[model samples]
Target: MTLLVIGGSGFLGREVARQAGRSVTTHFRAGGPGRRLDVRDRAAVLRLVEELRPDVVVNTAYVQADWVTTAEGAMHVAAAAAATGARLVHVSTDLVFSGRDVTYDETSVPDPVTPYGAAKAAAETAIKGLVADAVVARTSLILGDGDSGHEKFVHALAAGTASGGLYTDTVRCPVHVTDLAAALLELAGSTYAGIAHVAGADALSRHELGMLIARRDGLDEAALPTARQGSGPLDVRLDGTRTQARLRTRLRGAREFLAR
Candidate 1:
């Protein structure tokens, strides 16, 4: 199948392309055999969509550098998906949740805390109604050998270990990029649609994840901090019941990601 991966040149996007390329004939922009088309350019996007007529359009292109530009950019992409009959897999984030002490479900109401999350939420809204065949995978902190996807916890924990201090709080479910990539492909091909939370098997605090990485890397685990009061999200675990039942590959845990 000809799968069109938007932002296939980026970190997570590249991983998605790599995973998808292993199974199907794929194409991309900015170096991949396809024409360079920005999502914001409505005319160019429409033209590219009509030309490609891809079976699946997995949108991993997110311009997090500038919030205003980011939201504007996704509008046309959503429109293009609606214009064409392509099955759209619009990647989203966990930050759309308020990070309350509760686990968010696919049906949970969104309360984005940051501008980045807000933009993604807006994009989700813009496209959900536009396309009938679509799946929104709301993922969490993506980790792997490649780009960490703005993973402050990893950096902070490593920095703390290097500096002899780390945060005791700040919890998150750090999913591996490769695993996430697989899940994206699965969602694109699956019959299930709507917002599905594809994340790590276990949600650990920043300190805990840092400790795992440190120990795995043969560094001093003691150098990392432990969970203390007033850290980060005491609980960022999203209910993955629906995802678990649907996806063939079970979502991996944070420790599994660290081992990789």
Candidate 2:
């Protein structure tokens, strides 16, 4: 199957490309094994999808603060996929939830607090409306290979190179990038459409997850500073029980994946 990975230069997108049989990737500026294309451009997106005619298109491109890139960009990709009749597996985020104390399932409504969350929530809505057969795989904090922002922050904090402590109150299901990517690819190959929670099996606070990373990397976990998040939702966790039963790939938790 020919797979076209939008944002192929990204952390998760790169993995999707690497694990696929035949894949053509697209990048904004990460400089990887794909052509440079911005998802924000509707015409360019349509042209590329039309030219490739990929069987599946996984869009992983997003800018937290940029609505054009996150929400509108998803719309552009969804529209392109609809136009070309390509199966789309758009990567979304659990941040779409407002961090209510309750666990959210695939059917939960989005009530984002932060701008980034709002943007991602918007993307999810756009995709659902545009593509009837698209899979909106909502994942959480993606960590892997010591290159993710979360892992890098842990390293910087341990080395005294970063400011601000990890948030103790804010919580999420941190999935390994490889696992999330594999789950996404699996969804791409399947006929399953609509919302699927593809996050880690465990829900942990920022500080707790940092401690795990620090411990795994032989750093002093206790030395990692911690702080409470000032505003917005806290302890928002995705309940992937239903989604897990449908998947073959196991979504390992932070404690399991980060254990030494």
Which candidate gets the maximum lDDT versus the true structure?
A: 2
* Number of backbone-clashing residue pairs for each candidate, in the order shown: 1, 0
Give the CA lDDT, 0 to 100, for residue 132 in model 2: 91
Alpha-carbon error at 34 in model 1, in Å?
6.0
Candidate 2 similarity to native, TM-score: 0.96
TM values, all candidates? 0.84, 0.96
The C-alpha local distance difference test score for the whole of candidate 1 amounts to 0.73
Candidate 1 lDDT by residue in tens digits, 146-227: 3463344445555663333444565667788888888888888878778888888887766777777666666656555554
Q: In candidate 1, what residue range of length 10 has the lowest lDDT sum?
A: 161-170
Clashing pairs in 2: none
Q: Each candidate: what lDDT?
A: 0.73, 0.88
